[model samples]
Target: MEPAQLTAAVVSIVNTLRIILEYMQNRPKRRQHEDDFDEDVDTDVPESTGCGNWEIVVAVGLVDTVERQFWARQTSTDWWDRIVLQVWDDAQWLQNFRMLRPLSWNTVSYFPLPKMRADLTVEKRVAIALWKLATPDCYRSVRNQFGVGKSTVGAAVIQVASAIIGVLLLRVVTLGNVQVIVDGFAAMGFLNCGGVIDGTHIPILAPDHLPNQYVNHKGYFSMVLQALVDHKGRFTNINVGWLGKVHDTCIFRNSGPFEQLQEGTYFPDQKITIVDVDMPIVILGDPAYPWLLWLMKPYTGSLDSSKEQFNYRLSKCRMVVECAFGCLKAHWRCLLTRSDLSTTNIPIVISACCVLRNICESKGKMFMAGWEVEANRWHLILSTQTPG
Candidate 1:
């Protein structure tokens, strides 16, 4: 045959084989006999395709080999087995997931997750959620670390966060121990102080609906978290999910805590006499908030020495809330950067993080000093970057 004719014949034969293979792979299966139709019968042929018995066997073998190879490559070092399973020491456990191992296990034990797979145990689900929250990793990054699909990683994060909020939020963040908190503040030179109130912005992706409404003064899409922290840097109450454009006073006025304080129901009836004036137990706030009978703010504009001294004392007490915000963001880094979760869900996740922070604080799980340094570094970078 001529060279051109030979090449043409080979191409035609290759095309024909490609079409046949595709058809075989996609075509409907046919039963060879009545027994083949029986659901209980074992068949050599593939049930989903029209491939012959021998072809099906070969394909199954090949698939098994490829799957084994893929998993082997993914788990050669087996990060979970080598690092997580081996770390029984509490210090190392805290370093890895920002919570003591026992605390983590105990937290998840209260609300066990449904067994989705053989590998996704309740403990693993909690670990996955904590890892995602404690670091600024994307879903794909978390999947790679845990050897799960990206969708699984995302689902695990939301499920565990929801569980935390539902199970622990009320227990951990509340004013039930108001007297103890007031005493703690009194020890810090702010007599009759119950807590400190402040607001912070949590960055988030722009939503499709009214994206401009989420923009803050810094020109980034965000949500506001107005929290009241006790002297121990634990959240006693939080009002979250407000649009970033909302003012602090607006959020405070509309919060449940505001109504409680207004009715004289938030704090106890304890009071102290200062310069012949009876001062009731009150919460300290910044100048952005209204100065109610129960909410004290610093004097604005020109200040005399007495006013300045009062402001300094109030600020000193208010530092707890500022440190609480810093620690919350530092511990759960998802708050610092824009979260991949939807705008509606980010608030719940943030609330869950606050609850977890309170758990850690109340339990004496000290915040890792390194996290603050790293968080500050990232904050500087994010601040200097041009807003998008």
Candidate 2:
């Protein structure tokens, strides 16, 4: 083959460059016209007037027109609009895919293109919808604030939440260290290690079920939530799916995390025990959990100060899980309320929140560590618990 053919096989670089040059030369140039056709368009049209191909072309043109009109009007926003616009322009959010070009509102195909100058991106639309759902504001209030269709708010929120959880948040953080802190105390000895591993009654709208499988102590509808955090108080693993009626021990047995742990390949430094391979793992909880291996309990029911101190210390260490859960709830208030979430979707939502939390915490670890040193010194003195 010729050198040209070999070069062609490698890349169409030369050909592409030539084509680009030709395109630049011949491409349509905008020539300002005194008037271009009718400035306005006809609204009424028969739906069946065009064939599929013609309809597609016309649809694309309509979308382009909407985008163009939306952006063109933004240049002349009044003082009030300008304030809102300027604030939106200055706001920052996490976006790693920064290579994409800035979207021209005039050219983008938003479902309902802004009739007025202003328009929102899909992300902002979703965020606002979620905020409304989390807040006490009515749909009309939200519609006025966001300048969107009142009827579309609920649908938009559900769609955005579904997409975020289903497509974005199902990924689990890779487990490492597999740190285990096991301590057994007197009287009613209990496991205060992995987590309380108990099912909290989270009532939801009852769904059509096969039997009484999902019914729990509260009698409404609920799911089991088993969380596992490390010594540093970060979640290593969390299982949430079982019905509220399911025993914590049963949830643990079926959690599959223990299976991985028994295989000696779950997390880094996780080892399998030879004897009692199927034994329930040690996790932090009150005396209610009987199956835990390394259990810790306070002294007798008597009001001894030393016993109170031990319980207080245990509570401090256990408080890590509560803090992580609280932060997750605070950031994504959607979780705090009863969700219309199905069993299939709940785990994804939970996982995605964890991922976002991990991403933020990991990014801010260095900045956090600086203030944390001073805080840690005071914590050591004040805390009944020994430093891990």
TM-score of each: 0.80, 0.48
- Candidate 1, overall lDDT? 0.81
Which residue runs of candidate 2 sit more than 4 Å off their true CA positions? 1-85, 88-120, 129-145, 149-172, 177-201, 208-215, 267-283, 286-314, 341-347, 363-388
- Each model's backbone clash number: 0, 9
Q: Highest TM-score: which candidate?
A: 1
Tens digits of per-residue lDDT for model 2, 1-388: 9998988866766655565456445646633332443221222323332233333444434334232221111122242244443544412212211001132121122334233224546645544544543433555555555545554554555554455444434343434433443332111232324433333433344656743776665454566667666554455676766776787767766776767645644434422353556333344554555423343434447867867876776666566666665544444444544456566655655554554455445444212222334433433432332211
lDDT of each: 0.81, 0.46
Model 1 / residue 312 / CA error / Å: 0.9
Cα displacement (Å) at residue 127, model 2: 1.8
Candidate 1: where are CA atoms >4 Å away? 1-77
lDDT of 1 by residue, 172-196 (tens): 8887677888889888878999999
Q: In candidate 1, how many Å is residue 186 off? A: 1.7
Q: Give the C-alpha miss distance for residue 316 in model 1, angstroms.
A: 0.3
